[model samples]
Target: MTTAFDPVRIGALELANRIAMAPMTRSRAHGPGATATELMATYYEQRAGAGLIITEGAQPSVVGQGYPDTPGLHTAEQVEAWRATTDRVHAAGGAIFAQLLHTGRIGDAALLPGELIPVAPSAIPAAGQVYTHEGPKPYPTPRALTEAEIAETVDDFARAARNAVEAGFDGVELHGANGYLIQQFLSSNANRRTDGWGGTVEGRIRFAAEVTAAVAGAVGGDKVGLRISPGNTLHDIAEDDVEQTYKALVADIAGLDLAYLHIMESAGMRDLTASLRARFTGPLILNPNTLPEPTGPDALSLIEDGTADLVSYGALFLANPDLPARLAAGGPFNAPDRGTMFGGDQHGYTDYPTLT
Candidate 1:
């Protein structure tokens, strides 16, 4: 019987176990705008027990950032900042990848400083508020990206991918989930363009696929991966037909020959893997939200039965640095302090106790 501790090879990276540390944004970067801090590096080095560590969603450009202190990868200074962290993780004998994300319409006017109007697939403003430095700001009406601008954004993602490799990351994961730029393009409610990017599902997914191919070309196909959420609407995204839209999109992504496919597993009400598996023949990384119970044996069993190639844990790994060992020994895991989940000092970030 294969246990969670079993070593697994995912893409260009290999691990001692199938357990993975999901990319989680702590919003702890001191100087914002894509700059990584020493605290951030220390934070990652402490949690290297997992088979793999996918760093938090890093904004590809200035406008791609959403939160107050989230890191970016569009600058030389930012790249140098991240190199420090990656060097530490490598020295610890751990491998980590950067997850590239574009917040799209999730941006607040105040958060982005000069760029008040965020660019999205369409002009529709999501029905929600955004967390900003001062407070929550109502979702702003985003500008519809011009055909030229959309292509440039895709290039921004490609450039960010190239920067990640230069910064010493093992690979880059394209974030096509959480109602961001890619998801905004994927959502019919958000995308109303008649141009090459909007009408048909293929047209909408073209941005994501093209960006993936470009990044793969820049960083090698073996060093690229993508994460997707077919039915997620975290930022007021609306998908009319989840089945058809996702199936069509995945069918295109499946042939890309990238590293792995990360699925932010939602509810059992929707059988996610059933259709997507047919499209993507690579390793499947699963991230099940613990809406009720936190991560437990049942989640691991999915990996055991080969339903997923890897299991990604978010809060669990945040609270327990030695998460793999804790699970193996049936540990009393540390409960992550919700108040400190996003910001503050290193107290909650790296001070979480491992199993004694």
Candidate 2:
């Protein structure tokens, strides 16, 4: 039986272990052009013990950014800035993937530059507030993307994937989970369109499929990965037919021969998880739904049972830089500092002690 510490092959790369450090938003991209900072490089280097390190979501386009201080890959300077982080991780014998995310309608206008507003499949406004640099503000009604803009957005993802490779990342993961742009299009409530992009299940999954294909084409299918949440309702997203929608979407892209399919499981979706896992023949990385409590070391057994090829940990890896080492020993893990989890200094970001 394989364990979390076992080696696994993901696409053209071979990871040293099945322990992956999940992408997390630390909101500390304090570089020019929303680029990554040297501190961010240090943070990633500290956690290089993991088999893979998926960086925080970086917007593919300028308008794709929904939060302050989040990094982006839309500019040359941004591409150059990320090199430091990727180089540090590689030098430490770790593989890294840049997660490209676009917040369709979950952002506040205050976070955007100039008079630009958010864009989604439709002009509908999601219920809830988004945290801005100024304060928490209500989500604004996003402008519906014209068919031409939709095509352009797809191109943007492809371009970003190329940029990620140029920046020295092992691969790129499209953020189709956590109520982002891709999930916005997949949501019945969020995406109420009547064009080729929405309405029918086929239409709704079109944008996601196109984006994936484009990115895969830009940076070989073997260098691409996608993250999705089948039944997640975060940011007021409602999916009446969760299983049917995701099943179709996975089937649509399964032929791409992607590097992996990452599922951020929601509550009571174990059956859906198994179904999707069986549908996609590629490696599967699971961030299981152990809500009310962050994913713990116990999830490693999922690998031994063949439930997932690799298990991802968020909060656990955040607090413990050498999380795999601690898990191997089976004790003495550091608790994540809730208050300092986001938008802070080295105290909570890279100051976590390792069992040296």
Give model 2's TM-score versus the native structure.
0.98
Off by over 4 Å in 1: 113-116
- Over 132-193, each residue of candidate 1 has an lDDT whose tens digit, in order, gives 76778888999888889887888899899999999999999999998999999988889998
Assess candidate 2 and give its lDDT.
0.92
Clashes (backbone N, CA, C under 3 Å), per candidate, total 2, 0
**TM-score per candidate:** 0.96, 0.98
Clashing pairs in 1: 34-71, 34-72
The models' CA-based lDDT, in order, is 0.84, 0.92
TM accuracy, model 1: 0.96
Report lDDT (Cα) of residue 243, candidate 1: 78
Which candidate achieves the best lDDT against the true structure?
Answer: 2
lDDT accuracy of residue 281 in candidate 1: 72
